[model samples]
Target: MRNRLNRRVAAAASAGIGMTLLLAACGADAIESGGDASGGSDGGVDTSAGIDCAPYEEFGEIDGTTVSLYTSILAPEDQPYIDAFAPFTECTGVTVNYEGSAEFEAQLLVRVQGGNPPDIALFPQPGLLQTIVRDTGSVVPAPDAVEAAVDEFYGPDWKQYGTVDDEFYAAPNSANVKSFVWYSPSAFEEAGYEVPETWDDMLALSDQIVADNPGGEVKPWCAGIGSGDATGWTATDWMEDVMLRTAGADVYDQWVNHEIPFNDPAVATALETVGGILKNEDYVNGGIGGVQSIASTTFQDGGLPVLDGSCFMHRQASFYAANWPEGTEVAEDGDVFAFYLPPIEESAGEPILGAGEFVGAFADRPEVQAFQLYMTSSDFINLRAQGGQFIPPHSELDTANLTNPIDTLSAELLTSEDTTFRFDASDLMPGAVGAGSFWTEMTAWIAEDKADAEVLDAIEASWPQ
Candidate 1:
């Protein structure tokens, strides 16, 4: 149920907003397993958690208000958010109606254009936020409180990602490190191989693996690009990682912003660099199938071959730990683990490629703003970090909140002065190409064996004119 009370997009776009959010609409709350989400009746609130309401008392009488949150984060992974919201709701009588969908990236626009967007959206990509803001003019700017929290807790670059056209609209929420290559330490020890620290070293290892195999029974790496509706994103991740290493940060920015064409020599060279492993028959699709099978293989299963001895490495994000089987231990000296996808050249700093979710609000209702503000605070950051898969964006996040070694490593790289951090370029580019042509062309390049230049040219041509 989309509860707007009587407020439409026109009113929500304005600066002044009242309690006209979702209360009058009669329907089941998305987050609740059962029962009508009327929040609470008059003169009462849910105090089951026994949280001090002092912090929430400033929001005025928002006692039975509901704010709907919609995002791509799904079950199991979505549980932490729900768990964290309990304290907030217990303290402030604002019930949060949460919905997670696999089709969020594809269907968000339809909802926005159809005048039924959720009260708040967890945007995986900043580009889509910009697109909706510029095209529809329906997204409300962040409240003063939310903006203040961003200024206090987040870095300047994180703030910049949420601001568009000089207006701050969203705040950084969750983050993940993508510059990781998952592997098994014991397997390496048994095979007498060591972790690679540079691009050249990684390649040498790949070559040695192929030579060792001789018959190509197991390749050096395993990869996949298959994500429903958002297929080929993994390949784009590879492209972004390679582009960062080869073209340098400045060139990567130029390419993402379209200062240089997607087919520019620098970008094409990056593609070639990525292809050296992704396209090379001796390098990828280990344990799964041939290189072409990459198109159909789910990204979740991309790195699984490392466990079965069919492959030695799986290049993926830190979140890949979630894909490991229940009993599979993930540690430096345990059954499986990951290392940074080494720098291309020995330098003072290595580039870190990461992605994060931005909390963008569609309604300016007090309850909506309250939830938005809460999301940006250090309190939420700490609670969210406990959820395991999350890498909170706050500089103030306690190290004790980091639940795993991989997340600790990610937080270290994210905050380390010796590393240069950049958000995923595809997430910052316009959606037509970033989420559209870029994904399709990369899939074709891998599965269809399309020429690198053709893939580049096609993606460049699809950029918004």
Candidate 2:
């Protein structure tokens, strides 16, 4: 509790609004965003966000209402969400009291256990949502209008994530792509190297880079798993990506669900595959240091080496673009760009590894329900998409609303029929393991050179009975 940074902030003030026609077009099924307008007795709500306020009328009057929000997403990544809600607040007169903390997972539970939970929480993953649902008895199920929006816009698999024992409790708020290998396009062009389409090709490129720079400062890969208390999560992402490729989706599910042991032979194979790059002294810590440096370097700084030509590739999510220094170009012909991480064989399979936040409520008040439901709507999502570094998960999201090219690509790939998508495995497992031993053991695997089997055995042993 003492370590938690319980900083409170108001949503970004109302910004220039242009999609005034969106709510007016949600058709008959549009769920009303509850809350009263700041309108006077005779006058209706004023449009500070400059959009039509009619859509919110259905949620009923919520005059001068307030909703409290808590989450792990803090500034600078948090400013966009704050700014995006401007229009919603302007129309609904709901004051969203937001508090973002670094220790959200630990503190959220503390708050709940102490019977002072926030009105809503944007869970980084459903595993925590499951914990709250199964153990805390504090999570409020999604309202009818919220359920209708999800069913109308999302596939069953997404809703299943928030559902526990057949009861739905949340909706996806944002998404990210984890299967990207960011690189310097100009560097690749200068070296006459094309983006690899298969795992073998990527390895060949790695070998080529090593052969070209023998004893030189350049390396084929640079990575870091350090993220404060979340250290080693990046390594877990590496493991999950490898798991999706080597073991395929079915076995991957079984492993995450504990139908198969964490140390199952197949999972060990996946770990070895991850080791091929991450654990390989020849391939990692380019701008950082020795392979062990990966455990100490920050994940946000892990891939920055690409910009300085010290490393050739950094496998991370699309959201990593936000980490680049301001004014850095992120485009095909610009300073940096990302390629889809290749699979073992293009024809064999190329399942996407990804993650998203689930918006769950602790209070069932109409004002809270209104805000949660609005978050799932295309209007809010589309408006939010323009804020950059955000991928709209609404199935009907307008690509035009996405301001960045990478964001557009992520959104397109998310719904593309040609590819398969799966959420992060660590975020899906039980918290005791997924959020615990799995992280600590991975750090040891890199920092101490612990044998893969030993690390796997430790994690498997930690699984709850």
Candidate 3:
């Protein structure tokens, strides 16, 4: 079924309609920034920035060769890549066999250890890229050509997440702004509340909402830590955003680079702060325990209730906009807006969670490089915008083609003023600490009343030497 969908999308692209048309025809709206054709000029990509990819001369390719790709992308969401890659295959005759992201990672580990890795791998987290670079020694140092390609397609900070020891290990493919706080305008108006600008303002607003409601009903926040294998990632985002604002970019960078311990005072304080919110009787929709055990699927579905006036706000990635109630009109102009997670205090900068997809190559073949460059280029952005399968990472991409409110708002926040975007803390942390111990410890802290000190100790113990 997945292969058939890919072939159909490919056939359409080959016929020259592009993916954007396919998306619209399928009834998926391409969200655009600000609802205006101008495409949010505030902090958007500066068209003057020049990134030249002419340095690494294109290499000749051997026909009939195949490149195997492993990814965690679901079939429906991955249709775009399948469709997009079909063109590359036709142009270079290099067939691509893609697999699920989770299965890909597990299999890739075995293959690398056994000396038979794929030509390219699409890792979801930067931590995985770090692991591959440190373990297999098969990943080629991101060449000058790739670096130039990144600069051309994305902003300067774009490639920072995948960089290790001043060398890049992957190409950024999909990105979700994490610093956003989603809320229904109708709910806010019904509650007679205004969007808070600063962190204190947001807290004060939460307090007001709780005070007015009294019981656990009509809560101000909706939190779910229930993704099956990746359960605690949502909680991690909340902690990371707060930490970034509390500790400042310098300290946050240290934590990400493993220069400081994960249980450092700064990180601990951040956890305690989030815990306080979870513990608050009126803050979260179902209270601490309710949130702790709530299935991630339920948590995602909880957004509709917020729109129905059951909760006031949700802190999630920009992607959640897609899950809005079926009939809920996301602003007639197709703009989905999210508040920047207010500063924890009167901080100098507003911290945001940067989450997105990245592309990496295991083989240094010319065809591979060409496909990488092309996929991340303006051409692909235009194609994706038309298809509604992706949101553009490059600010310069023609957003006029986008109509989905979530996609449009995500692009808007990418270049919004006073916003400081940083990668998710866990993604930057060592995998064991980020994906394993952190989730387990945080969940335990929330549901089991684990000692704060004990939680801190557990996280500290998990830090890589």
Question: Once all C-alphas are superposed, what RMSD does model 3 give against the true structure?
Answer: 10.9
TM-score computed on alpha carbons, candidate 1: 0.87
Q: What value of lDDT does candidate 3 attain over all alpha carbons?
A: 0.60
Find the candidate with the highest TM-score and give its number: 1
Q: Residues 99-164, candidate 1: write the lDDT tens digits.
A: 876567778889999989999998888898898899999889998888888888777778888888
Q: 1 or 3, which is superior by lDDT?
A: 1
Question: Which 10-residue span in candidate 2 carries the lowest summed lDDT?
Answer: 22-31
lDDT by candidate, in order shown: 0.76, 0.75, 0.60
Cα TM-score per model? 0.87, 0.87, 0.76
Give the clashing residue pairs of candidate 2, or none: 12-82, 35-62, 36-62, 36-63
Runs of candidate 2 exceeding 4 Å displacement: 1-49, 58-61, 345-348
Q: Candidate 3 at 86: error in angstroms?
A: 4.3
Clashing pairs in 1: none
Count steric clashes of candidate 3: 18
Q: Estimate, for each residue in 1-465, the C-alpha lDDT of model 2 and write its tens digit.
A: 101101100000111212211110000001111222222221111223455566568788896889888876654465566666667788788887767765676778889999999999888767878988999889999999899998888767778877888999988777767888999989999998988767888999999998988985899999988776667788998899888888888888899899999999999999999999998888988888989999998777899999999999999888787778888898767898787777763433657888778889998887898898888887777666776666645676665666666665565455444556778898889887887889899999999999999999999999989
Q: Candidate 2, TM-score vs. the true structure?
A: 0.87
